[model samples]
Target: MVEPLRPPPRSARDDVLTYIKTLHGHQHHDQLVAVRSLFTWAKQNGLIFRNPAGRIKVGQYEYAMLQPLVPVQVDRSVAVATTPATRLILTLVAVHAARVAQIVTFMLNDTDLGNRRRTIAGRVRPPDDLTTQRLLDWLEHRHRRWPNTANLHPLINNQTANTSSRAGSHWISAAMRGQDATLERLRVDRQLEEARVKGPDPLHLAEDFGLDEKTAMRYADSARAQLPQAAEQPSQ
Candidate 1:
C-alpha cells in the first residue's frame, strides 16, 4: 500500500492558531482571544517570522464567534428555564452581554446591587454592558431564596482546594443540565400562556412587565417562533 501523505509544515502562528482552536468553548475562547491580541502585538513589534494569520480575515475564525442573544429571546429563555440558578445565569448573560462564565460566577457584595456591576475574573474583565442592570434586577427578584448574606460561590469548582470526585462532577453536570432544561421549558410555557391570556405581540407584555423594549420584542418574537406551526400558520 502507498504510504499516507504527511501534512504540510505549519508556521509558528499556524501552530498557535491550531492550539487555540482546540479550546472550543468556555474560558478557552477568552484565552484564544488573548493569544490573538498577542499575535497582533508580535506583528507590531516585528517579531513574526511568518504572518500566515494575517491572511485570515477578522471575524472569519471559529475562535472569533460571539453572538449576542436578542433581548426578547433572552427574557423568554430565562423565564422558561426551570432552575432558579439557570434563570439567573441566562438572564445575566443575555441582559448584560456577559459571558456564561461571568454570569455563573458573579460575586455579590451588598455594594454590587447598588453599583449594578461585578468584575469578571480570569480573562475579559470588561464591566457588564447596558444589559447587566437588567440581569441584576431579575436575579435579585428571582433568586430571593438565595441567602441574603453577601457571599457567592464560583460557578466552576474544578480549581477549588476541595477537588470534586468523578461522581460529583457527573452529579453537578446532571443538576446543571436539568436546571437549564427546566428554565428553557418554563420560558416556552410562559410564552404560550401569554399568547393565550394576552396576544402574540410581546411589546405589550414586556411594557406591562417593565422590561426593556428591545428585550421584550425579542422575547415576543422567540415565543411566537416557538409556537406550533399550525398556530403560526396564517388564516386560510
Candidate 2:
C-alpha cells in the first residue's frame, strides 16, 4: 500500500528542504510548500528552527501556470449563480477577470442607493463577508424606511433577489456563486478526464461526468466516430 505524505514538524524544519526533495520533482515542490507552512505554525509554538525551505534553491522545477478560462466557461459559471448580483459579480470576475477587491468595490459603489457614498479614495479594497451583509441589511432597512417607492428597485437586492433564497446573503455573492459554479464545473471536467484516462465504458463515464445514460452513450458514440481508423482497428 502507498503511504500518504504528511508535513514534518517545525523541529524538523532544518532538515525539511532535503526531505521535500526526496519525493519526485512535483511532489517535492508541492510538499515543500506544505512543510514550510507547518514550520511557520511550529515557530509560533516555540519550536524554534532554521527554515530549510527558505535557504534551499527552488530553481530546479518550473512553476505551473494555469490557463485563463474561456468566455463560455465564465458565462456558464455565472449562470449557475442564484442571484443577478451574484451572477454579475461572477461574470465580472470570470469575464472582465478583475480581482475580488475590484469586483466588490465596483458593485458596491454602483449599487449604493443610500445618502452616504463610498468611492475609490485610494487603494481599492473589497469589503469582507460581514461588510457585504451589512450593506444588504442597510439597503433593506432604507427600503423599509421609505416603503411604496416610485422605483421598485429600491426594495430588490438584485434583479432576481425575490426568486432566490441567497438574495442579500453576501455583498460579493455574485463572485462567490461564480466561484462555486466554476469549481463544480472543474470537478466534473476533472472526473471526466480521469474516466477517459481509465478507459471506462459510456455508462461509467456518464455517471462520472454527471450525465444521463443516453447522453453518455451519445458522447461515447461521438468520440468513437471521431477516433482515427488506425486507432480503432483491432490489433494485428
Candidate 3:
C-alpha cells in the first residue's frame, strides 16, 4: 500500500529561532529545563543519538529595579512642570505617594479640603502642606479653565472636560513627558523616603498607601538595604 506523503522535519535553525522567542529572563530558564527533559528522555529511549541542547549555555538575568532620581533630577522635573495639572500630579506622586491609578480615579468629592484629607482608592490619607497646597492650586486652575466641565474626576483635560470620563494614563504620562523623573519614579522615591524615615515595615506601607503585599514587600526590601543603621533606632 502507498504511504501518505510527509512534510520535511524542522531544522536546527527552526529550533534555535523558537528558543530566541522566549523572554530573556526567568522564562529562559524554564524553557531550557523543559527542553533538557525532552532531549534526555529521547536519548534514553534511543530515539536520538544525543541531547543537542545540553551544550547551550544561558546566563542568569537578574532583574534590577530602576533607581530613584537624585535631588538635581527631582528639581529639574519640578522645574519643567509647566501646568497646574502637571504640578499637582508630580506633587501627588512625590509627596503624597499617590499611584497613577488612584490619581486618575480620584473625584472632587474624594477630598475633604477643610480636613486636609483625601481618599485614594478608598484609603484615606492626610495630605501634607505641600500636597494640599498643590491640590488647591490645581483645583482652582481646573475650575477656571473648565468651569462648564461635567467630569466628576478631579483631573480633566480638553478631551474629557465636556464628558463624564476621567483622564487616561496616557494623558497623565504625556503631561510629564519631558520631566527628568516619571510619575512612577517619583512615587517609588516617596515610598522609599517614608521607609527610610519610618523604618522598613511592609505593613505600614500597605496601610498607608493601600499597596498590595507584593508591592509593599518590594519597597520594604529596597529600603532595608539602603537605610542607615541609625534609621532603625527608635527616635527619642
Candidate 4:
C-alpha cells in the first residue's frame, strides 16, 4: 500500500500570514496588528522562541474600484424604502457614509437633528437636510412603536433594543433591490466623491475619514483612475 502524504507544519509567521490573507481591507490590517501583539507577548514570556509575526509587513491595500451608484439610483432607493426606519438607515449610509455598526450602536444623545449632525464612532458627521429630515420622521415612528422602551439606539426591532449590522444590511438590501448598493460601497462612493472634489489629497483624505495613510492612498489612486473618464464626458 502507498504511504499517505502529510502536509508540512507551518511556522507562526506563515500561519499568521495565511490567516491575514483570508481577511480584506481594514479588517486584514486590524487582524495582523492583533496577531503581532499576541506573538510579541508570547515571545516576551518565552512561550515562543521568537516573535514570528513581528517582522511580517501589513498586506497591501488592494482597492476594488466598483462603479458607484448614480444619482437616479439614490433617488429611487429613497423613494422605494419600505419604512421610516429603513429610509433613515439607507439615507444615513448613502448620504453620510455612516458605518452600519455606528448606525446600530448610535445613541439618542449623540444626535442633534437641529444642527444636522451626529457623533458616529467618535467622529462628528453632518448629514444633509434630507437625511436629517428622514431621521426625524423615523424617530417619531420609532417612539410610537415602542414607548418607554429605555433603549438609546435610534433604530430598533420588535425583539432587540439595538439593531444589528446584519439587520441593517438586510433592510438596506431589500430597499435597494435592482440596484447595486451596500454600506461599504456607499462609503467608497462617498470617499471617491470627496477625492474627486478635493483633488485627491491623500493626507487630508486619511485625516477626514480616520484611515491609515496607505488605505487613503488607495482611495486617491482609485479616484485618479476615474478622472480621465469624467473629463471625457460631454458637458450638458
Tens digit of per-residue lDDT, candidate 2, span 94-187: 3223344444334333444343332232323233444345446655664665454333232234343343222243455434353534543443
lDDT of 1 at 129: 47
Residue 9 of model 4, lDDT score = 85
lDDT of 4 by residue, 1-236 (tens): 99899888888778777888899887887888888888889889989898888898876655567455698766666676779987887777766667776776777888887776888778887567887889889889988887776677777777664433223545435555565555566777887788888887899788777778887887788788888889999999
Worst 10 residues of 4 by lDDT: 161-170
Which is better, 1 or 3, measured by TM-score? Answer: 3
What is the full ranking by TM-score, best candidate first?
Answer: 3, 4, 2, 1
Q: Clashes in model 2: which pairs?
A: 86-174
TM-score to true structure, per model:
0.29, 0.35, 0.70, 0.66
lDDT of each: 0.47, 0.47, 0.80, 0.75
For model 2 the TM-score comes to 0.35
Write one digit per residue (lDDT tens) for candidate 1, span 1-236. 99999998877767777776676555565666666677778878999855555554334233322122345644544455465444445543333334333344454441254465455443222345434555455555534543242334423232331332111233223433534333334333444445444665766655444446655665566556556554767996
CA RMSD of each candidate after superposition: 13.5, 16.6, 9.6, 8.1
Following a full C-alpha superposition, what root-mean-square deviation does model 2 have from the true structure? 16.6
Distance from true position, residue 43, model 4, in Å? Answer: 20
Kindly indicate the candidate among 2 and 3 with the higher TM-score: 3
Tally clashing residue pairs in candidate 1: 17
Residue 69 shift from truth in candidate 1, angstroms: 6.4
